[model samples]
Target chain A: MEQTTIRFTLNDRPITHAAMPYRTLLEVLRDDLGLTGSKEGCGTGDCGACTLLLDGKPVTSCLVLAAEADGRKVTTVEGLAKDGKLTPVQVAFIRYGGLQCGICTSGFIVAAHALLESNKTPSEADVRAAIGGNLCRCTGYDKIVRAILAAAYDEGELVDESASMPVMEKPLFTEGPM
Target chain B: MRSFKYYAATSWEDAVAMLSKNAAAQVIAGGSDLLGWIKDDLNGPGAPRADLLIDIRTIPNTSYVKFDAAGGLKLGALTPLVTVAESADVLKNYPGLAKSALSPASPAIRNVGSIAGNLMQRPRCWYLRGKDFACYKKGGDFCFAVTGENQYHAILEGELCYIVHPSDTAPALIALNASAKVVGPGGAKDVALDKFFIGPRTNVLKETVLEHNELLAEISVPAPAANWKSAFIKVTQRDVYDFAVVSVAVAGQIEGGVWKDGRVVLGGVAPTPYRATAAEDALKGQKIDEKSARNAGDLTLVKARPMSQNAYKVDIAKNLIARAVLSLASA
Candidate 1:
């Protein structure tokens, strides 16, 4: 097999590796670099479980050859966090129950993060279209939609101060109500 | 996948020379389709494995979409499909082409798939792609679709093989009067997009007229008329990540609510993009209305020969043709 030395940036770190011509980026990331967060649901591009950010755009790593990643920057699901803090999309996934079985969570989070970076306030249709490539058999996409919508709002915006008090202390009904 | 030597061609001349020297080499652009085929082991028995893969994605100056008054639109072969789908010029002038680019597959595939690679990709017929069946397209004696499962087979031009052309952009380009610039050892030549594809009868082994060493360098679409309007409608099983069951591309001039000089091309129904000449003629000089659109659509598939399992495609093709033409006319 023919081997070539390729240099690129992986998760903000510059790295070099020897790769065969036929190896895909998915293999290099999972087997060679130990960045296995990007799972491979389908070897084809139909299932976007292996989605990653290549130069700030989401693409199927399974469809992309490792040679094509030479001299490029790759951001996997593992690189989405910074300073030990979870990204908004990740936090929203937990609060809104955006994942079940967890196999498709990484791809969905990465795709949603890319969407939020480009458009902070995306409509329901826009969110659906943005993640149209991804498949989640467990969640049925309702929670995923809610999670993305919640992620769009600021953390302070989601808190309701009026609802913080106990229900028994508040009036059962308004004065004007029958 | 089989082991192969990879070469990144820096220039057009270098790429052509490398291709001419190695008979077993294949040029790869996006590798969106090629890699899947390679993994599926579609290269049948006795067929030499692709010994070399010439990576053309790194070639500079060959990944642009330029538009000029004289040239209309010139798209480098290595230009990604997403670029074409998102280009403002394409969306404004050639809306059908833009819609075609955005209609098929998912965003991930469109992000990396090249326009030229989409045009040159092979059929998606199950029999031809499967390992067990050595159908006619794979140089076998019989076409399994003639008696086997063929819901997605061609309905118009199927003789030796029943594989449908699996390209959404080819019909749109043909409707827009496009041509491909090809380079090889003999030099460069411009071939019209209409003539680019070859039927199964012409050569069962290949879908296009491109020789082993020839490379599709760029695609050029002529400028449209002053009142040009276009639309593309694809009928698929699902909303996303599915190939067209039957797609229609319509481009023409609508002057004062009257349609003229129309071009209609149907995909996923023939070995090549089927140009509905009779339908185009029927649509010419007709007033923009649903009735006229229906008549034109009926005329388009007057001579369609549908297989046993794919008869529904004729109706789908007709409906899409009418819908596309009417929508473009009203736009």
Candidate 2:
């Protein structure tokens, strides 16, 4: 198969690269871009180590083709720190003991960030729903959920119980670079 | 995975044209199933590595779901399982369909998997999907599931092949009397959901009745009856990403406190989605009480011939049928 050039915003900077058509998004990010925070626990979509933000929504990068990420903004764990300051989710992860081996931390943070960006104040159930895709074998999920909750509370937008909620609109899924 | 020539279709017409022109071409939409098959090197019996791939994701108008004014649902073939599970109209009128799509697989798989791809996915039999076994599902002359670890094998129709339909949404759709619109080089045509599968004796190479060049265009679901209630129950070893041991989809209308028009379907027990006609007959014209439901469940499993390790599936199917029927009765 002929390789195709893919253009996307990685972390905060725009990147353009040529890759094989069948390579996974996980492989491209870790190999071509040298961003290895996204681990490959399972080549299939079962393990969420390869989770990343494509256009600000969390998805399993392993299942997605690299060619599918064309013209999209891709975020990885390397992008979480700004000006040497840890992002709020990252800080909460440290303070709340959300890491053990730290392998799953990147994917969990990405998943939590995507969840909180749309839902300012999500309930425990909502947090669980959001991060259900990300699995952590070392640390039980209690601390992870707690860390996300702490971040949400510091952000100071509590869930309003009386208001009716609407389903958030999702981003359009497009084919990635092949 | 073997390297293949990749062509991204800007439109459905282009995809159909490419498929018609190349016999070795495979349609890839989500790759939730295809990639696994390729990486595992288990491409079904007589099926080789796809030499050419037609990426169906770029096809216009193939990723949306809409409802028409005539009380029918039109689902484009590439609509994601997550979207189908979360659709308002789908949840309202066809909750069973939503439940089936949402039941198994991780949230990420649901997000990436397309309904059409799931329907076209190869069998989940360990020998078929596994990389180690070279059985009849992988072009071998003998089926290993007959003597190998037959736990997940079929119980009802274990012919030369012991595959269970891998689509989490197919049984529920069949229960709702859905039809598929397939477009090929010969043009578009529709096929009923029940008649879609080809068994071991029929065609071992293909799962569905679709022609080589045919691409599923849309899935059309007929209107439900006025007093209908439906439910889908799947039983598997794990709550996530596992194929069903036995599943049940029940849709029925209750009129005058008696079950009227109804359809009962079973999954994971046959090559294709199996209808429980005897069970449906037992409930028709009768009030769906606990006794009748149990009887119906029993009737559904009367002829089950489980393989060496899957005999437990019969009881599981019976229990699931009763549970599904009772839920419908209560609703």
Roughly what TM-score does model 2 have, to 2 decimal places? 0.91
Per-residue lDDT tens digits for candidate 2, residues B43-67, read 6445567878788888788888787
TM-score of each: 0.94, 0.91
What do the candidate models score in CA lDDT, each in turn?
A: 0.86, 0.81
DockQ for the candidates, in order: 0.61, 0.32
**Candidate 1 regions off by >4 Å?**
A155-178, B45-48
- Candidate 2 clashing pairs? A66-A177, A67-A176, A67-A177, A67-A178, A68-A175, A68-A176, A68-A177, A69-A176, B105-B241
Q: What lDDT is reached at residue B115 by model 2?
A: 88
Write candidate 2's Cα lDDT for A1-178 as tens digits. Answer: 4797889899989899898887888999998888999988877766788888887777788878788888888888888767766767876776667899988888889888888888888998888877777779998788788879878876432222223432323311123311
Worst 10 residues of 1 chain A by lDDT: A165-174
TM-score of only chain B in every candidate structure: 0.97, 0.96
